[model samples]
Target chain A: MMHQQFQDCIDACNACADACDNCAAACLQEGHASEMARCIALNMDCAQVCRLSAALMARGSQFAAALCRVCADICRACAEECGKHSMDHCQRCAEACRRCADACARMAAA
Target chain B: MMHQQFQDCIDACNACADACDNCAAACLQEGHASEMARCIALNMDCAQVCRLSAALMARGSQFAAALCRVCADICRACAEECGKHSMDHCQRCAEACRRCADACARMAAA
Candidate 1:
């Protein structure tokens, strides 16, 4: 079994990924999906990182620290773009992003 | 505009999300979909958290620090589970996880 700390990070990543997908789907159905392109792109990117980060943590890779750093940066950007939207999904996504970003930062430090 | 650091985090989260979704889709198509249940579930969870974390960071939420901490933990766990599978996609996902996890950790520390 992996260390508890590592496991915790995985959980957070998973949650963040789900939130992003839902937010993206919601955005796609909105009237301004075209305007939300940046948000959509960021959301897609954030989701990808969350998944990758989780996998790396699983194997206890030596490069996980570096990866965490990159993932953290992306999450912040995605949040900013999503925050621009006035929809409930965007607002909820923004909240999730902040939480995930904080979690990733902690893991990197560890 | 958000500080460069925040923007970077968002970018990383979005990338990770895409990787996870792709990996999950590939996993679903594999013959051992039943065996990959845990990975799929973790993938889904990681994706959600990444989205939420990004959104939170976008708004400069005060709770972002805590959220990042959580996101990091989940990423680690999902990585571990995904690593269990011997498929190429799992391996790829594992690598992506490492990258995203490191990125997130950095954001948390910031």
Candidate 2:
């Protein structure tokens, strides 16, 4: 069974990934695609890492601890970048990134 | 400028996330949704973590180094789990995960 902490981290990561993916797509559809290049890039990147970290922790992989540490940093940066835009997608992505970052940070420390 | 190594890690994470997201959708479309419960779960997780790690590294977040460590582990486990199924989607996700895991591992140590 997944530990409570691990589960929480996974939830955070999954939620963040979904948010990023949705936001990226929305950014692209908003016709400001050029301006959203960086945001889209960051969103895509953040979603991937969050998903991977959750999978690793779920399986109790040997590298889970280490991955959590890195995932946390990525989430934070993505949050900051997403936060830069006032678009709905960016705002949502930022929140998700922040939540995932915090959860991953706790997971890393654990 | 984004460091070559960091950029590489971000690429790996992005590729993996795309692979996982596509794979997950494929799994659902194939009507194997019930059987793919675990695989879908893992894919979603892997994609999120990979994305987050890439975003974190792109901007040189303070937590980048630590997050890299966790991202590596997550990628590895996701790869293994995805590799279990012989489906094309699983195969692709597995390959992406392995590449991401290796890239993240090197980045973490650096």
Best by lDDT: 2
List chain A TM-scores, every candidate, in order.
0.91, 0.93
User: Candidate 1's residue-wise lDDT over A1-110, tens digit each?
Assistant: 23335766766776666567667766766677898888888888887787677667754566777787888888888888888878887887787787778888988998
Kindly provide the TM-score obtained by chain B of candidate 1 when compared with the true chain B. 0.86
Best by TM-score: 2
Tens-digit lDDT string for candidate 2 (A9-35):
889899999999999899999999998
lDDT of each: 0.72, 0.81
**What is the lDDT, from 0 to 100, of the residue A35 in candidate 2?**
88
Q: Would candidate 1 be rated incorrect, acceptable, medium or high by CAPRI criteria?
A: incorrect
lDDT tens digits by residue: candidate 1, B49-72 = 766776666545667667877777
List the candidates' TM-scores in order. 0.51, 0.56
- Which prediction has the highest DockQ against the true structure? 2
CAPRI-style class, candidate 2: acceptable
